[model samples]
Target: MTGKKKHSEGEIETVAPAAMGTAEWQAEFLTQRRLDKARISARFAGKTLDNFSARDKGRKMLVHSAQTYVSGFNLNKEAGGFPVYPKGLLMTGPVGCGKSHLATAILRGVIEKGYSGLYYNSPDLLRDIRATFQPDSDLTEDDLLEEVTTVDLLVFDDVGAENATGFVLDRFYLIINERYEGCKPIIVTTNLNLEELENRLGKRILSRMLEMCEIFGPFPEEDWRRRNLR
Candidate 1:
């Protein structure tokens, strides 16, 4: 289903705060910026993680999923805000249902709580990587690899939105496969159901994803966007 464009994808934009000293204040300041990363992660989770969506006189509430709890990811949290684990979240639901928001909310919240994070849609991220192929582009494979491996958190919205071309699938596999070896964490939101996910993610990635992260609730009240639009 088409989303109602209720959530602001732009909210995740964060200016990297700077620090250039060993002073306690400077160290703390840098830590705060690092936390900004996690804040973005948490926000991503809150907005996209399934919440019930309902319209009431053209207004929206953007509810949260009752079946979910953030603390359960404690092992994940204790390891490091986005632990860069082999497995990460794989949110499933209809389009415009806040799957992306959940990812965004979590990213944002975690950053706010003092952690690092990175966010991007799957296709856009791939596009950026492809652009680096140009001779004038400064980004190297190492740069692409770092985003997946070094970031505090890596968020992939619309995981399979790109056409499932062999090249695209291969690229997707490479990132996930490498991260699996490194034990990095990731967050993925998709407008696909269980069957569709099985089809799109394939058996391998699906197994890794499930092994790494818990499935957020996809209940009737889980669409936060619908609430906002109302």
Candidate 2:
């Protein structure tokens, strides 16, 4: 059905494509789904585009570019084609360059579209995994792995900031491998550029990540945090 509006002169003006009967019911269902998604997304993403501070005009422009990707995401298309998604994003830059901020914002966008997601600081995630080894800890190693591996999207922040011990590397490998094999999407933020990242994470993991992600920049600017402080 076509929706119409009354013009000032009392003429009918076509306003939009309207849904009637079954179509209207379906539209209401979709609207409710979006609203529910937005609420769930807020819980997972403590911060949002509104809180992400851009230090300069150039940085603000970069944030907008990321936002465009989030807005354009198609949940049905991604799920139907599982494991062969268009590349997810990998933002690499120096410390405090807003990498995490932008990445989280993007994840939030996807979540709002009814896809589930998770955001984790690399070191914190490792620490939690380690805790599961203690007898007193409530979480199991499998518990952590299952959640991270199965999420619609996983945002791994500060990738190269971890200690990179052998144990840590093995755990990291498991997470990456599961996601890779499942064809799940991921967004990672790191301070290391390609060369340094390749050295830190090894060629195999590096190669897979490169294949899965579209690298965004070293942003090459002062710390966004400091810039925002002023």
Candidate 3:
């Protein structure tokens, strides 16, 4: 067979690596998935980093911090390797500091990564779920809770936006605690600092949240929203 022009019929196969795949492929796949999710994300008033103006400094910090938390991630990375992820984020700073913006921007990444995510403001969540308790209401509290407690990523905006009552606190705990047990990731945005957060959410919820998240502070030189308001 030497020096002979021999050709055998065989299929040229392409396989994506389960691990250490080509960076281009992985990045491309992730980008596509995000674009798909972004469509849905946009429908809900969620916008990516690009939508907001001049978040250069905060955007870099947020992305890097998210990557750090997400990389080397294990459901059991915490004590007993709780099936739920220990890594969560508390983005705190002044108003218009882009805390909520950053949370959604990360979701932009999640979408590209082809993952499930849920976004809700703390006040709206309480109102919506509580409204179901009205006797004439069609949806049951259990039904609403089930949907909420099961998302892959649950985002809470305006965390201390409302003055929470005991009922809301318990309800909030139930949802977040279940996520904790299930290893789901949660992202919270707040205008409040740690001390103020404790006063608002209370010690128990605070303890649980701290157990789950690493705090990321975005220090803006000015109130971003105020500046943006033309």
Instruction: Score residue 181 of candidate 2 by CA lDDT.
Output: 81
Best model number under lDDT:
2
lDDT tens digits, residue span 136-157, model 2:
9888999989988888888898
* TM-score per candidate: 0.65, 0.73, 0.70
Cα lDDT tens digits for candidate 1, 101-197: 6567566544544456788787877787789899998889668767666675677788878887777777777877776666667787788776787
Per-residue lDDT for 1-230 in model 3, tens only?
A: 01233255664444434553568777776766545543234543556655655546765666566555544444444456434454778888887667777777766556555466677888888888889989999999998888778866677888988878889888988988998787677888888888999999889888888887778766575676587576
| Total colliding residue pairs, candidate 3 | 6
lDDT at 67, model 3? 57
Give lDDT: candidate 1, residue 54.
Answer: 42
The list of candidate 3 runs beyond 4 A from truth reads 1-46, 52-59, 66-86, 228-230
Candidate 2 residue spans exceeding 4 A from truth: 1-46, 51-57, 78-84, 218-220, 228-230
RMSD of 1: 11.9
Candidate lDDT scores, in order, read 0.62, 0.76, 0.71
